[model samples]
Target: MLTWIALTALLLFSLATYMAGRRRAVAVTAGKPAQLHSLPGYYGSYAALWAGVPAALLILLFAMFGGRLEAGLLRVDPPAAVQELTAPQQDVFYDDARAIARGGTPSETIYDGALKTALEDKAAKSQQISSLIQYGSIGLGAILALAGVFIAYPRISPQFRARNKVEGWVAGLFVVCSVTAILTTAGIIASLVWESWRFFQAVPVHEFLLGTEWNPQIAMRADQFAGAGAFGAVPLFVGTFLIMLIAMMVAAPIGLFSAIYLSEYASPWTRSVVKPLLEILAGVPTVVYGFFAALTVGPLFRSFFNWIGAQLAGGSFDGLAQYLMQVQNQMALVAGAVMGIMLIPFVSSLSDDIINAVPQSLRDGSLAMGATRSETVKKVVLPAALPGIMAALLLAVSRAVGETMIVTMAAGLQARMTLNPLDTVTTVTVQIVTLLTGDQEFDSPKTLSAFGLGLTLFAVTLMLNIVALRIVRKYREQYD
Candidate 1:
């Protein structure tokens, strides 16, 4: 409800801002030397941005960190048992506490906790104090806005330069929004890094990095070799690569070809019809794809393999054929293929844009040199757009690597050191999801291992992006 309210306010604020700024711009330059300082639309945009951007940002910050701040102000010790609860369990604690305060459940531990009691008290106090802050903030903001409007309201005054002022405000707002997003990303990375460091302290960095097997099972007794537990991230990473490879194999060709067909071959009418239809594929929830892969696709692949084995054995039962079939029902191939299909729009849309953005002059030049359409496209347009195309592919690969829902639902969660695309293999994303999903102790190795996996995945993607950028830069230099 709050979210809806905030969003609606943002939209209304934006519209009002545009109108006010546009009107002000027109009024400020009613006549004389600086006739029409800027496009009225730009002035309107400035007002809209100024009116909504800061408040929207404040709302977002409050949503993300307000609870943490409120929690901090309470100064009560977090329940040790509650601290051990899994991520989902921790959310339940918050929910139950809210419910308790609202007179829902008396039996809940959240209703009984010292921390909860303190928070409830603090929440009341904070609400009282916040009424003052909220009014002050909004009052101050409105005053500033009115002052801006009053200054810009005058008609053709010598000092009036509404356009410049409005643009400056717009530019400032843009910078602030960009900084907020960047800072949020940085904060996330910092948190992940800190947690990963803690995990590395518990498990040896060398063992985690260089060890060959990744059996995280803790030993119940002393002197058990298998119980020693291997943390070789190699297998998980290999599994990730295999899945990505399969996904790319399916997505790259399909997406790229689709892009070509849309950008070059299709009429504008056809493109209008096809583009949205393809993008609809992107909108399909990944969880749904997961089920499709797991239930429908997995079984079909298993059946096909069984039929092939039967056919290979001439419809006779053969012991040798059974030995040949080692892959599980949820083959990596099925998951990868589905994931690739999911990524088709991602790659194709990006590729299409880059291809279209390629200079017409290049194609015309190639054609003037007696090149055919395909030849011109291949030799001139593709080369010109290759950097962006590579960037798009790299982005798609990153998405494929980080994708979770499809893999969690479809891909087998088993982490094995195998290159077989037909075998059920786990991915880093699936492992992290499963590890963090349940009702377990946070301090347990099982939970913390998710952080390690996240860090590793982050590092891999970061490196891939860096390498992709470097490659794009190098390719760009060839043309320059």
Candidate 2:
């Protein structure tokens, strides 16, 4: 509801601004430029931008920080009566108080005595305080808005220098919007860095980086040994590479061949018909691909192997026997094949654009020298576009590695370090998703593991992008 209100307010404010500026322009134009003190439209726009932009920013700020602000304000020291409880117990007490305020009771043991009585008292006080703060803020906002209107109205005069002021304000807004995006990216990186630092405190950095085992299971009690908390993330890395390789094997050749055929071989009419159809492949939701992998592709591969076995064994073989005798159902082949299908359009479309961007002069030069079309494409055009193609393939590999749904649904969740493509395995993203997707405590090693996985994934993707950018730069320089 607040989102709708904000949207409505922004639209109304913008429209009013446009109309006001238009009216002001007419008034200024009615007289000579020298006779006019200032442009009329400028005054109207000044009022509109001032009214809309600040209010929108306030709404955004409130939505982001309101709960935290309220929590901060109400974080009073629990009456001395509750001080005897341990830190965890105090947390429990505070949670209970908040729940009680909302007409709910907590299931945790409420230490009977002053602690319980104080909790009930504090709950009422916190609720009243929160209500007062909310009402006061709304009143303040309304008063400020009225003041802004009063200040703006008197300046909406013929002599007012509203145009210059408003233009300057608009330019400032543009800069702020750009800065906001940069700040958001920095904020995400900072948060990941902090969390990964905490994880490293619990698990040694070397163990995480160079250890070979990846068993993440830990005992619930801190006093007990953390069984299988082996920090060796090598198996996860191996699985990530293996799965990515399988997917790339499927996607790269098919996508590249499709791109080459579309760019160099297709007639104009065929290109027109086929390009949109190929692009449509990208629009298919990844979850759909996940289901297709698990329900359709996986079973189909298993069936194909069974059939192959039956043919080889005079039709006397069972499914499992056939699979064992002829083929592996969970081999990297199935997952890679499906992943390749998903990537075909991504590679083909990117490759096609780069190929098309190759100057016609080069192609014409090669053809004029009595070179065949294939020879021209291979020797001149493909060579020129190879760097871009490699960049695209690298990007596809990154996507495949980070992909969660396809692997989670089809690729078995086991964290096996085997190089065999036929063996079921998992990737970092899959482990991260499973680790964090439940009623898990935030401070637990299990939950914290997700952040470690995320940090690693981020680093890997970042490195790949850097390499691709460098390669692209080198290629661009060569051609230039």
Candidate 3:
């Protein structure tokens, strides 16, 4: 509230300063604005910058100090009962006081009068500090604006370069944006690496990277029946790759063929109708696909497999009946197939664009040499678009690897090492979600394992992108 109020007051004062600065500039020009150094709007904007920047900095300073001030004020001397808490419990007490001061119930076991009196004192101190900061910032801005007007009014001749200064600030803003993006990426990587390092300290890196088992249940008490958590990530990666492979298998050929038809074979009206209808599949939520996979596709596949199994069971291939019966409502194939459907638009749209980008002269040349349309597409256009198509496929693979909801609903959360697409499997994303779902302690390896999984997923996706880049660059040289 204080921050917002300060900013609003600062903005209003800046507007007033802008008006005054523009009026002063015109007055300096003896009512002939054309003789002024820069445009009236530029002068006004410069004055507004002088009026707001100092005040904005002050407001930011206050916000940076506000949290520590509030926490210190609330935590000082506390109540008798809260002061008697253990170190950890005292942290909780301060948290409770902060919550209560913010209109929540007090969780500390203290007297009501003491709690009320402390909260009231905290509120009074907060108000006093906020008002002081707010008014002081506004006053500072007023002084700065007045000083700027005195200093700048005489300098408003034709030689002044207000536009250059403003453009410099604009360039600074761009630099700030670029730095912010770099910092954000660095922060994410740091957090992931830090937590993953902690997890690896508790669970061996080899065990996590190479072990096939992925049970992550940790027993809380000594008498608990759970074994030490197995942090093996192999099954997760394998399952992820299996499902991704299946998804790509289903999506690549189908999406590529669809793109080919739309780009090469389909007439204008046909392409217009079919392209959007096909792309609509991408707009459907993954959860909807999850439901479709689990409720519809899984059962259909199982039933169809069972019928096949039954037919073959009465013959020498009776051993397949047991395997076919294992096909259930949740499996990698179902999730993969649905995920493929979901990714069709990504592939089709990219491939279509890439195919369309192929030079028409190449196709014409092929046709002029007596090649058919299909042969021209296969021999000329496809090779030219191959790099782009490969990029699209890898992009789809990355999407498949990162998918969560569809795998959760259509593929069971059992990490198993098997080639059976009909069997249930789990992926890194699914386990990451499972590991972090409840009130799990961050210090526990079970909880920190999510960060580990995230790091692994990041590495895999990064490697894929690198490979795709190499392929694109390699083929680009050949074609370009």
Candidate 4:
């Protein structure tokens, strides 16, 4: 609340500084705007940026790190009662004190006697330290903002080059944003590698990569009845690809053909209507798709297959009939079909844009050679759009590989290595969610295995992207 008030005050101050700078610029030029090197608004914006940027940076820094600094200062000199507790207990004690200071609820552990007294004393100290940091930072930020106004407002003259300075600041802000994104990606990859390395220390890399089973629930103690965990990731990889293949089988052709028709055969009115209706499927939530899969498509497919099985029950295909009869609502086929329906918009939208991007001159030239519309589309437009179509398919494959909710709801979480789409299966993403769903100890192989799975998925996705990029580049050269 204090920070928000400070921010609001700083905003108002910056606005005031902007007006002062603009007025000063016009006054220095004898109220003749033509005499200024840049517009009066540029001088105002320059002053506003200087007043806001430094102070905003200070506020952001304090907001991000103030609590940690407060905690560190509080822990520098602990109470005797807190010193007597174990490390974890001391952490809890500090947490309780901080919570009390902030008027928030702490842990359920009831405190009494010396510990309770110590908590109260520490809470008071914490509150004092927190206020000191908050007020001190706000005060320092106000001083910096005032300093910026003094430094910038006096420089508002005819030859001040305010626009160039403002552009430089904007350029620096863009550079900062680009660096932040790169650093964020680097941090994610590094954390995944470090945690996956720890998991590999407990579970052999070869076993995780090649072994067939994937039960990750290990017994917590020696005498427990639970079996030792199996960490084979082959089943996960198989199921992931099996479902991906099935989804692509349903998505690729349909989405591509839809794009082709929309771009080539459909009239403008038809395209306008059908395009958004198809793209509407993209905006639907994945959870909703999951529910649709579970409630509607799964049962519909099961009934249709069961009817087929009944027809073949007493025939020569009795064995096949029994297998088909046993098929459940939750299977790879249902999930893949639903996921494909979900991906149709992604492929269709991107491919439609790509196909339309092909030069009209190519189609005209093909027609000038007496080729039919279909022949022109097959030979000229499709070849020109092939690279972008491949990219769109790659994007769809990535979506399918990363999907979880639909697979979780429609496909039962059974980690079995089978290509049969009729069987229940699970994907790596679903297992990752399962492994880390509840409170989990990071030291345990079961929890750390999520990172291992994530790393593997990341590697596969990267390799697929590399391959796709190479294919795209190769085709692009020919087309260009």
Candidate 5:
């Protein structure tokens, strides 16, 4: 809070300096605009940047590293009893002391010896040291800010190109932002790959990819009876794709047809009202869609299939009713159907924008060649927009593959492969969530397997995106 107050004061001072610099620039002009090198506003901005930028950067650095610096400064040789405690025990002791010093009541067992006295003393010293560091850092920031103004004020003359300097700083800032994003992505992938390597060391990679079984429940002890767990991932891949296929079957035609009507055929009033209502599905939370799937769509499908099964009982397939009765509310079909409903807005909005981007000249040319409006739409406009539609569908597919809540709520987590959508199944995402929900150590394969699944999912999604981009490019060239 003190740092914030100091920074706010610095900002207000920078603004004042900016106004002073602008007035100085005007004074240097001396009733002649030609005497100035840059605009008054540009000079003002340059002065503000000089007055605040270095100090703001210093404050940011202090915020990030101040805790570590204080921790180092507060370190004192512990008593023999405290030194004998394990590392985690020491951490707990320090945590309690810090909390108590901050006015929190201690609930744990009292130390009751020299250890308690030592902790209280340490806490008091930490508080005193922390306050000194905070105030000192603010003073240092003020000094640096004043130094920056002294260095910058002299260069704010008529001959100095303030605009070029400001633009150079802006360019450097942009480069820093870009590099930060690139490095962040690299770090994420590297972490996933490293942890996945550890997982594969314990479980064979080939079995994980190919074998039929997927029992991730490992025996906690060798004598515990559950076999050395199987990690075969085929069932998960199959189920993921199966649900995704069902979703596309429902979403593709409906979303595409809606996009076409809205883009080409709908009246202005109808499009304005209907488009927002349709896009509202996109804004509806995924958890609500999950509930809709589990509570509403699941039962409707169960009832429909049960009736069909009853019909099949009197027919040649007399034993099918017993099988269909097993089809319950929680299955891949229910999840996929509801997921398709959730995906419609993504498809519609993207496809509508892409269709609108198709050149009016192409439609006009097709019509001039004696083509009907429907013929022009089918042949010229659609072909032109097909690449973008395919890209949208691929994005929707990626979304479906990554979805968890709807699948968890609507599809029971039975790791078995079945072509029948009525059968229970689980996806990679659902299993990853299940595996990593609790506090578990990375020493066990069960916890590390989540990272393995994440890497595999990332690789598969990357390949899918690459293939989609290739197909889009191939068609785009033909259209061009």
Candidate 6:
């Protein structure tokens, strides 16, 4: 609360400095605006950035690290009661103190005797320390903001290049954002690698990659009946690709054809009306798609298959009929079909834009050469837009591969290696969710296996991106 108040005060001060700086620029120019190196707004923005950025950084820094600082200070001289407790108990003690200091309820564990006394004492001290940190940070931020104003307000003269300085600051901000993104990606890859390494220490990588069984449940004791866990990932990979293939089979032609019609054939008014209506499918929540698959599409497909099976019961196709009649609600077909519906807008919108971006001169030239509209579209437009179309398809593939809710709801969580779309199967993402759902011990292979799966999925997605990028680049060069 105090940090927010300080930030608000600093923002108002920055606005005031902006107005003052603009006026100063005009004043220094002796009422001649053209004498200034940059516009009055640039001068104002320069002063505002100076007045806000430093103090905002300080406040944000305090907000990020103040708790850790407070905890370090509190733990410098521990109570005898706190020191007597176990490591976990000591953690709980501090947690309870912090919660009590913040006027929130602590854990259910009742504190009694010296522990209770220590908790109350520590809570009071924690409150005092928190107040001190908050007040100190706000005061320092105010000082820095004032200092910034004093330093920047004097430099708003006509000869000063305020525009260049402001742009430099903007460039620095962009660099910081880029560096932050790179660092974040590095951090994620590092964590995945580390955890996967730990998992491989428990289970060999060859077995995880090549072994057929994927039972990750390990026995609690050495003598328990449940055999050692299997961590074969091939079934998961098969299921993931099977669903992705099914989804692409459904989505690719329909979405591409829709894009072609909208871009080339539809009138402007029709395009405007139908495009948004089609894109609305993109905005529909995946959970809703899952529900549609579970309640509507699954039952419909099942009944249709069952009806066909019943019709063929007395014929030569009786064996195939039995298989069709036994089909369940939860199958790869249900999840993939619904997921394809979800991806149509993504493919159509991107492909439509790409198709429209093909030069009108190409179409005109082809028409002048006696080619029909469809022939022009096929030979000229599609080839020109092929790279972008490939990119769109890759994005849709990524979306399909990463989907979990639709798969979990519509497709059963059985990691079986099968080519038939009617069979129940689970993907890598679904199993990752299942493995990490509840309270899990990270030391165990089951929990750590999630990271291994994540690493493998990341690798496969990266490879796909690389292959797609190469294809896009090859076609793009030809077209260009």
Among all candidates shown, the one with the greatest lDDT: 4
Compared with the true structure, the alpha-carbon lDDT of candidate 3 equals 0.81
Per-model CA lDDT versus the true structure: 0.73, 0.76, 0.81, 0.91, 0.84, 0.89
| Residues 223-290 of candidate 5: C-alpha lDDT, one tens digit per residue | 44323547888898888888888888888889999999999999999999999999888999989999
lDDT of 1 at 430: 86
For residues 276-300, could you state the per-residue lDDT of candidate 2 as single tens digits? 9998999898888888888888888
Select the stronger candidate by TM-score from 1 and 5: 5
C-alpha-based local distance difference test score of model 6: 0.89
Each model's RMSD to truth, in Å?
8.0, 4.9, 3.4, 2.9, 2.9, 3.2
- Cα deviation in Å at residue 416, candidate 4? 1.4
Worst 10 residues of 1 by lDDT: 219-228
List of clashing residue pairs for candidate 6: none
Query: What TM-score goes with each of the models?
Result: 0.66, 0.79, 0.88, 0.90, 0.89, 0.87
User: How many clashes would you count in candidate 3?
Assistant: 0
RMSD of 4: 2.9
Give the C-alpha miss distance for residue 108 in model 5, angstroms.
4.2
lDDT of 2 at 396: 90
lDDT score, residue 436, model 4? 88
Give lDDT: candidate 6, residue 369: 99
Span of 10 residues, lowest total lDDT, candidate 2: 137-146
- After best superposition, candidate 1 residue 335: deviation in angstroms? 0.7
Best-fitting candidate, scored by TM-score:
4
How high is the lDDT of residue 463 in model 2? 88
- lDDT for position 397 in model 3: 90
Clashes in each model (backbone N, CA, C under 3 Å)?
0, 8, 0, 0, 0, 0
